[model samples]
Target: MTQLETAMAILMKVFDQYAAADGKTSSLSKAEVKTLLEKELPQLIKQAKNKEDVDKLIKSLDFNGDAEVDFEEFVVLVAALTCSCHGRQGKK
Candidate 1:
């Protein structure tokens, strides 16, 4: 798969995890993201009450401003908060 596809998949995975656990992942689309925010993340999602906001988010993390979040950017945004340690590789 191309880098774009990988990025989309990762985004979908993160979206699904949070949506399912904390919100709703049934849609997984822009609308769904808004819904997830309204239903789950009331605080931050409040800032993104519509698809346009979601698109803005996608653009913000898109880095190159390609209007699309590629794998590299997606990895940076989604993976930054994850992983207990950055340099450590072995299991905890």
Candidate 2:
């Protein structure tokens, strides 16, 4: 697979792995999202000013107000972070 394809696959796999924690394969619950961030995005969690910031992130990511993050919502978080990092790199 191409690099982008591989990255996409990895993203799906990671989301599935975390989302399955509560026997729910379709979306991630709040706890699952928190655990995923703590384990997979440690640096991002570390950079958060406080727990409330992370809570705000989780709330913002739930665009549909469903209280759970499905694949599309998860992708938005990843894409936003990727773009933010890419922008920083370009500035450097």
Candidate 3:
């Protein structure tokens, strides 16, 4: 997949699984996304206008926001930003 795909995957994975206190069964609520943005990806999540923006970002990455993303999703978003910080790079 491409870098955009990787990043989307990461965001989706976090929202779909890791972001939730209850585990991977639901999406991150708007408030939770804001908190995470303030902490984890302060820059990206900061620009988010509203739930719509979050939904857009999420769907853009998921390409449909099917509910979950995997490691590949992470790569797409990070790669899109050219963060190059994640050790995984891509794949797996």
Candidate 4:
């Protein structure tokens, strides 16, 4: 697969890996999102200036107000994070 394809696959796999905790394959609950962040994104979590930032971030990602993040929502989070990271790297 191409690099973008591989990245997309990895995203799905990671989301699935975390989403399985709640027995729902379609979306992630608050607890699942917390776990995914704490486990898969320890570094980013650490970068958060305050603990509430994590909660706020998750809340913001729930664009549909469904209280769960679907695959499309997850992709938006990933894309935003990627853009933020890319922007930071370009500064150095």
- Report the alpha-carbon TM-score of model 1 versus the true structure: 0.34
Runs in model 3 deviating more than 4 A are: 1-38, 83-92
Over 4 Å off in model 1, which ranges? 1-47, 80-92
Q: What TM-score number comes out for model 3?
A: 0.47
Off by over 4 Å in 2: 88-92
Compared with the true structure, all predictions reach lDDT values of 0.54, 0.96, 0.58, 0.92
Error of 4 at 82 (Å): 0.4
Error of 1 at 7 (Å): 15
lDDT of 3 by residue, 15-77 (tens): 555446546444444445445556778767667777678767655655445554444554566
Report residue 9 deviation for candidate 3 (angstroms): 17
Q: What are the TM-scores, per candidate, against the unseen true structure?
A: 0.34, 0.93, 0.47, 0.90
Residue pairs in clash, model 4: none
Clashing pairs counted in every model: 0, 0, 15, 0
lDDT of 1 by residue, 1-92 (tens): 99989967867776666446435434233444446446554655566578677667645665675443344554564454344346544456
Cand. 1 Cα-lDDT: 0.54
- Candidate numbers, best TM-score first, in rank order: 2, 4, 3, 1
State how far residue 19 of model 3 sits from its true place (Å).
6.3
lDDT of 2 by residue, 1-92 (tens): 99999999999999999999999999999999999999999999999999999999999999999999999999999988998988863454
TM-score for model 2?
A: 0.93
